[model samples]
Target: MPRSPHRTRMRLAALVFSLTLLLVMTTLGIIPRASSTTTAFSFASAGDTSTLTAGDGLNSLNRLAGSRADFFLGVGDYSYQSSMTGDVWCSQFKAKYSNIEIGPGNHDTGETNDTSGTRSYERYVAGCSFTLSSQVVCGPVAGQCYGKEYYFDYPSVNPIARFIMISPRVFNVTGVCTTTCNAVAKSPCNDTTGCWPYNKNDTHYNWTASAVDSARTTGIKWVVVGMHKVCISAGAESCNIGTNLFNMLVAKKVDLILQGHDHTYERSKQLAFNSACTGFTTNSSYVLYNSSCVVDDGSRGFYTAGGHGFLKYAVSTDRIDIQTDFAGTYQDSFSVVSPTTSLSASFTYSPASPTIGAQVTFTATASGGTSPYSFDWNFGDNSTAQGNPVSHSYTKAGSYNVALTVRDSAAPTPNTQTMTNPVSVSPTPLSLSVSGPSTATTGSPVAFTATASGGTAPYTFAWTATGGSPSSGGGSSFTTTFNAAGTFVVSATVTDANSQTSNASQQIAISAPIPPLSASFTYSPSSPLPVLPVTFTGSATGGTQPYSFTWDFGDGSTATGQSVDHSYLLPGAYTVTLTVTDAGGQTAKAYQTVTVTIL
Candidate 1:
């Protein structure tokens, strides 16, 4: 189900050259570059690939494809079997993935050429195309264009990352020694021409250094270098990529370094190349162990191990996540986080104990993130609002968890922060009502009662009236008397324990005071004789109703009723009196002399 690996490698090599030209065109402003907008993208990296005939190699490939990466970085060591080109790896890979970017390895160019007179390294470079969002750039040297040394900026414009691919220890198979031709040797080897090695003086090393510096000046957030030889690994492969390049990358603060010579998967702890860690030498046996330069050890999720897998990178402006996975199974993972502050939010609301139908004002405050933040609220009553300061009212009173979610304008995706707090809604507000007689007589004491209800109990009342002595009183009940007879309003305000208040007023009608009582009396005749029958009548007014009368004749006798008859036995001038008493106990008297002698 595959074609010859040789054909695949040749095509890939041509593709790399064409990609280099594309990058050059981009540099000349011939093509449109990416905008400042930050977009999330992913890629997978691995090397030492074998045919998909069986084993973990095929599964690893499937896993890389299934990851749905934007591109695949072939770290090198393609077609481990002899006579096979890159078809065993590329045929299935190209069908599954969108693009592959090659970084040449020693094995790719060590052996003899194929029947078509094409080297595997050259074939790989020509076969794999560089079609990622990043712009590919060729090496500065005239001959070093593809499969030798190159670099690219991911997301072209305002790029956050720069990837430099180089072959530090690579050699072409020569006809000097057929027996040892397959073996990779250092410069001045017995079989072939001198190989390109990793050192400060090497062309590849110089290009890599320049690329790293340029990325920093251009504001790139991350720099990753890809090579085929092992610089530091748990595998048996020596540090063939040289200590100078490794130290340079580390000192420059390169974020990640990927290589493929070692078939087993291995990742290092974050190491520093400062004076504390000491510098690495050209000794192949040197390895870093228990060094203070380890900024973060394999302890907090960052790991170091040996296995068969690939590294998947999910890159964004704020962070880069790396996962070592094989056939859908992940073995190790770590994150390279940006130093940007984390987003956080908090909120405060007015009327801590709000009643039903009361408007609650919620003001949200955010911090530690990008500017131009958006706010949203969930009132827990199935109601929602947006903006920094929002208002909401609840129909029913109860406790609810109010949530405020704030989003900032961070690149790739907006950062979000949410905060929840409990709000207790009061059942009802404090109310007061004053009740008394609707009509009252002037100068009479009127009893006014005030009733208060609702709101955190233990309420107090303040009574006030338009016309009344002691116009203000405290407590639930108040009494006031109106001196004048007119319509007066009596009001009472009740305040609950929470200091919430409500008022109610009542109108009272006061009439004028009653007049004093008076009494009058008259006899049937203008003059009456005591000897004869005398009649007297009494009446009263201006006091309460139901009057009683008492009549005293001059003959020294008394009678009770409104009208009375009396006769005097002796004829003499006597005093007669009539006393009228109203129901209110107000008495009035009237007197007259009766001539009873010779009438």
Candidate 2:
């Protein structure tokens, strides 16, 4: 459970200070790098960084990640998550790319055969303790967190976007990497011997579908899906045969698919995953090469690079520049954009500014797009809507940005047309509350303290009292003395930094000083046994009668009335206590002990 806002703020203050210090330290080479700034973020990636090869391929990639990339993401096989490779390679990899994000690869998971591979990968790659990886484990996989699926959003980008990572699943029927059902890599290709357990029938496929669908509806500029297994690749034998999963990504308009597994680098033209229509075969006899499904259309953009060559990507709201680098040289580069990327959709929020629980209606308008547009809305708070004109109410007060992605049409490839607007909800205005004695003697001085909440801080206070002389005043609290016995009103007005003001008044009743009261209690059967009842009588002196009595049996039970009885259920020495509240609202307490023995 989360703490109250006040407590959370206090806790955050200390953390904020620590982070600020750490931020400076990281720049000074004390701590590791953190997430990128909201303006821009770049990253490097690769798959098959197997230590078994014993080459400097990963060293070159590590240099790229350490110097130029804001972070590093692996397609899967880093050779760091497997017991076979041990922790040396993984630790070195992490040391260089401290902020690395990844999906489990076959090599990382014991060549897709050993369960320990999954456990090791989960502990190292997807562990919550990897504070630098941006490992955002949201929602559930297989009804509970398997540490294999997670998603994150970059809200600070020119147009906010989301990235999703899903685990490679076990094949429901044919135990082959979904993408490599038949395209198993040939000689010099480790894939032919073993492959990922991914299959279209597995739950992960549905998870991928649901993720891309939700990303589209949430107004994300791009849904970049990543995993360790290549769906389609070259320079490596028979990669993923997951035509079913590819088709789903294409239909959901997934903008990017980052994959690994093959030992080569190749780029496919924009194409769909429709193997049935593309005339690709599922049998290994015909689908001998990566050219089976030629990239020609905008369905599945299959790109692969071999030999530890890393991929670098510069992402933005306008365009994405992708490059495959091997030995520090660029192998291929490409750019991608949607036709509706230039389109815009904006919404106007009623009241300009909102208050807690206020119903704010957002009216959307789209431009630079064909008519009959479809609107997908993201309110920036995890909730979403689809209609052009939507109404929402917020429970908390904070500034929020609402995103509206409008698509001109559904047929063919839809473009990304986003129009964003921001709304600020103010907290329930400043409130003033004063706490002090309710009753006091005539000509006596009483002290009161005033407090303010819910508005900008650094508040100024003004105090006023009737039928009383100010003994002291100013700054949230004051002391006042009364001369006559009467009811007096004390009001406190508070003004915040924004000059907003509110006032609250409390009534103080002054009377002739009553004699101080003395409280005493007597109980029958001072030496009682277990389960025996004892009656207690409370006596008081010098105060108004018709007093209320409260008694504590000290055995986890309580009673009320001037005289009452209680019983101890267990054998023990207990204290019987009484509190007498006089008619004048004065209270006094007294206690007595009783021994209950086991009989």
Best by lDDT: 1
Q: What is the C-alpha RMSD of each candidate to the true structure, in Å?
A: 20.0, 27.1
TM-score of 2: 0.41
**How does candidate 1 fare on TM-score?**
0.45
lDDT of 2 by residue, 1-599 (tens): 12222211000001111222222232233322222323356766665564422345545644566557776665565553224443555566665556666556554544443333223444444332233433354534333232246776654443356777665531211122333222233312222333323345455566666767777677777677776554554434344535566545544556677665554344333333335444534442222223433434554443343323566767766455665565533344544433432467677889787887778888888765445788888887888999868888887878888888888754576656787778788976788889999999897888889989878788999888877897336887798999999888888899999899998888889999768888998888878877777888888997887688898888789989988878788888888789999998888999888988876
* lDDT of all predictions: 0.67, 0.60
Alpha-carbon deviation at 286 in model 2, angstroms: 25
**Model 1 misplacement above 4 A:** 1-39, 111-118, 173-180, 183-194, 266-307, 328-330, 339-599
Q: Encode model 1's per-residue lDDT on 34-120: one tens digit a residue.
A: 222344778777776666655566666666678887777777767755666554456666766657888776666754332233454
Off by over 4 Å in 2: 1-39, 52-55, 80-86, 112-118, 126-129, 132-135, 142-147, 155-159, 170-202, 239-241, 267-308, 328-330, 340-366, 369-599
